[model samples]
Target: MFALVDCNNFYASCERLFRPDLQGRPIVVLSNNDGCVVARSAEAKRLGIKMAVPLFQVQEQIDRENVAVFSSNYALYGDISARVMTILEQEAPAVEVYSIDEAFLDLSGLAPHFSLVEYGLQIKRRVYQYTGIHVSVGIAPTKTLAKLANHAAKQYPATQGVVDLSDPQRQRRLLGLMPLREVWGVGRRLSRRLEQQGVTTALALADCSPAWIRSHYSVTLERTVRELNGQPCMELEACPPPRQQILCSRSFSHRITEYNDMRSAIAQYSARAAEKLREQNHLARVVTVFIRTNPHSQHERFYSNSASRILGVPSADSRRLTATALRLLKSIWQPGHRYMKAGLMLSDLYLPGHFQPSLFEAPESPAAMRLMQTVDNINHSGLGQVRFAGELLSSGWQMQRNHLSPAYTTRWDQLPVVRA
Candidate 1:
């Protein structure tokens, strides 16, 4: 069996973890530059505030409704996600982190040992105790059904945060009641197609002819069908390797009018991307930098730009990657344009140890390796960011606006208080 564990209203819950006063209030987290609503609490949802609703479009409604608004506080959310995952790691035998707010646990061998529903309740209680966040667990024979069961658990109150679909009759009934669009792989296009074919529910799709699905869609769709029928098409992956692409980006609080300011933002984003590349022991042959003006601001001019540079050799070295990134920024940068956001993307990635050496380029000496290690260590320890000989710091950079939250879990100074 596989169990899918998902956090409820992750971003909003993160906010409540710190400010307990907002527990029952309508809360919403805005997107970069506070442009739109990216996340909404249950109360906010009840007010009919949609996700990605532009701030200007809903400002009147939000004000009239007295909704509690917050800028995207990623630091707090990331820390909370880590804590939640740590709790799951201790309770489950093995866990695959599916996303920031979701994970899949292997429960194949443990099903006979204990009741799955009881075990899931224990997990929910422990996670809440440690992180002050609520989670919903779904158990099924396959990942797809587990995901469906998880959604059901979250939708209905009687489940009380746990749902098991191991029984065939219960699985069929739930699938029959669930909308086709609610299934994992069925999106708007596919859902419409399925509806046109008289398949409006998940059970209907599961009962479709396999030959027709194979002929119309790819083998991937066929596998989804099998997984929905309790045949596991996907195996549990342990220690999946690092990502092949890394991106670091954010929108500025206000439109930037100067070219130097744009360069500064790109440089900072590139430095962050480079640090991640080194941390994961990955090398990139291509560096991409992009800049854009706000699309929603009627008063400002709109401009979008992107530039890419290919390196002679793939490298995880910060100096080489940052140099390429800056060059890419130079190519993409425009004069006299107001930019709202800029980002750095590293692609054509490969593991550093697996990289093929160039015959012409000289290898780094032991001293050079030690120096790179020192820089990485210092940055990791939070002393300072990356520093290189050729790189010059730019003064005009956008500041992170939502960094005011207390680091209650990660830092000693910000730890929560308790009365003796």
Candidate 2:
């Protein structure tokens, strides 16, 4: 058996963890640069504040509805996610972290000990006790059905955070009621195609001919059907590999017209991407920089640009990547356009120490390696950030907007007090 555990309103719940005052209030977390609504509490959704609604478009509605808004605080969210995962690891024998707020636990052998519903309730209670966040769990014989069962558990309160779809009659009944698009692998395009074929529900899709599905759509869709029918096509991997492409980009709070400011933004993004690359022990041979103007403003011109540079040798070094990224920025930089966003993408990645040495570029010296190690250690220890590069401390770059919440968990100065 497989079980899916998903946190309800993950980002908003993270905020409520520290600020208990926000419980039952309308709350929303903005995306980068305070651009749009990325996450909303149940109360906010009750007011019909749709997800991804632009902040400017909903500003008046927000004020009229008395909605409480917050900028994205990833540090707090990441910390809370870690805590949740830690609790899960202790309770489950084998666990797979599906996303920032979701996980799958293998329950194949534990059925002899306790009922599935009781096991799920214990998990929910323990997670809430540790983190003050609520979660829902679903159990099924296959991963696809487990996901569907989880969706059902969220909607029906009688399930009490646990829905089991292993029974044949119950599985058919539940699948018949669920919309086709709610299935794990059926996207909007596939859903429309399935509807055109007169298959409008999960049960209908599952009953479709496998040969036709294989011919019309991908093999993945065929696998989804098998999984829906209680055949496990997907196995839980213990340790998934890191991502191959690392992209770090953001829209500015305000449009940037100056070339220096654009360069600084690009450099900052490249430095961040490089940090992630180093963390995963990988390096990239290709670096891409791009800038774009606001597409929504009628007064602004729509302009976008990109430039790619191939490194002589793949590198995770911040200095090398930032220098190459700045050069790419200069190539794509246009003088007159007001750029609203910029980003950096590092691709063609490989393990750091395993790359083929290039004859043209000199290998990293001992001194350089030591300096990089020292810089990374100091940043990790909170002595200071990576300031060896001038671009990091340049005056033209804008500050990140994570100013609202007190640093309750990370910083020593922001720790909460307790009476003895």
Candidate 3:
């Protein structure tokens, strides 16, 4: 058996975690630079506030409905997500964290001792008691059916956020009611093609021949079809696979034209990308820098460019990545253009101890590794932050976050204040 647990309105729920006064209120969290709606509360959705809608276009509706707005605070969201994942990991035999707000759990052996529905209720209660985040749990024999069960839990309030599809009859009925696109692996394009072929529901897709689905669409869709028939085609992965690429980019709070300011943004992004590489214990042989002006601005001539450089040796050292990124930035940056965004990408990754070393090249120095570890420790502690020289203080490259909530869990000064 498998179970899928998903946090309800993840970003909005995180915002409401500390602000109890906003319960049952309409709220929305904006994306980077407060650009567009990324997450909305149920009340906000009821008010016809669509996802990804620009704030300017919804300002009147927001005012009329007294909607709460917030800028994206990743530090806050990441901390809360870590806590939620911790609870899930402790409760389940094996867990696969699918996303920041979703996880899959293995429940193959526990049924002999306890009811699966009761166990699901326990997970919900414990998570809410500990983290103040509501979650929906869906249990089934396969990952595909687990996802479908989770969708049913979320859509129908009578389920109370728990649905089990272990019974074949119930699974078929639920799949019959589900749109084809709502299946785990069917995407928008696949859904359209399936619709044209008169396969518009989950049951319709599952009823197709597995070999026919594989030949017409893909092996992945064939696996989805089998899984929908209650056969397990995927297993829970306790350890996630290493990322093939690491990217760090963000839209700036304001447009930048000067090459030096853009250099600072690239350097910051490279440092972040390097941190991720080190966290995963991998090295990157290629670094790329990209910068672009706002294409939507009709008054200015549009410009966008990117350049990649191969490192002499694959490395996860921030200092080396930052220097390489600055060189790439210099090669691609066009002066006199108002750049809206800049970022860095690290690719061609290899595990640190597994890759063959060059006969002439020296290995990473212990002193350099120690220094980076110390810096990372300080930053992770949230006591203070240390930066490389290229990451200039007051660089004016920060993203817009005018309506950001306080970092209630990660920052010392921003801790929630209690008054009598």
lDDT scores of the candidates, listed in order: 0.82, 0.85, 0.91
Q: Against the true structure, what is every candidate's RMSD?
A: 2.7, 2.3, 1.3
Q: Which candidate number would show the highest TM-score if scored against the true structure?
A: 3
Residue 284 displacement (Å), model 3? 1.0
| Candidate 3: clashing pairs of residues | none
Candidate 1 per-residue C-alpha lDDT over 1-420 given as tens digits, one digit per residue, 9 for 90 to 100:
999999999998888887877878999888876778899999999999999999889989888988888887776788889889888888878899988999999998888889999999999999998888999999999999999999999999999989999998999999999999989988899889878889899999888777789998768778878888999998777576788899988777766777667666766677678778877777788888888888887886788988898777776666677777778878877787777778889999876556666898654334644666788898767546666533344545565445245666666667778769
What digit string (tens of lDDT, one per residue) describes model 2 on residues 1-420? 899999999988877777767777888898887778999998998899999988889999889987778888877888888899999999888889999999998888888887888999999999999988899998999999999999999989889878988687898999999999999978999899889989999999889887789898889999998888888999876677789899998777777888877776777787788888878878789999988998888997799889998877888888889899888888888888888888999999987567777667775555765677777898878556766344644545474465256667777887767659
Lowest summed lDDT across 10 adjacent residues in model 1 is found at 388-397
Find the 10 residues in a row with the least total lDDT in model 3: 352-361
- By how many angstroms RMSD does model 2 differ from the true structure? 2.3
* Segments of candidate 3 deviating more than 4 angstroms: none
TM-score of 2: 0.93
Residue pairs with backbone atoms closer than 3 Å in model 2 (clashes): none
Candidate scoring better on lDDT of 1 and 2: 2
11: Cα error in model 2, Å: 0.9
Pick the winner on TM-score between candidates 2 and 3.
Answer: 3
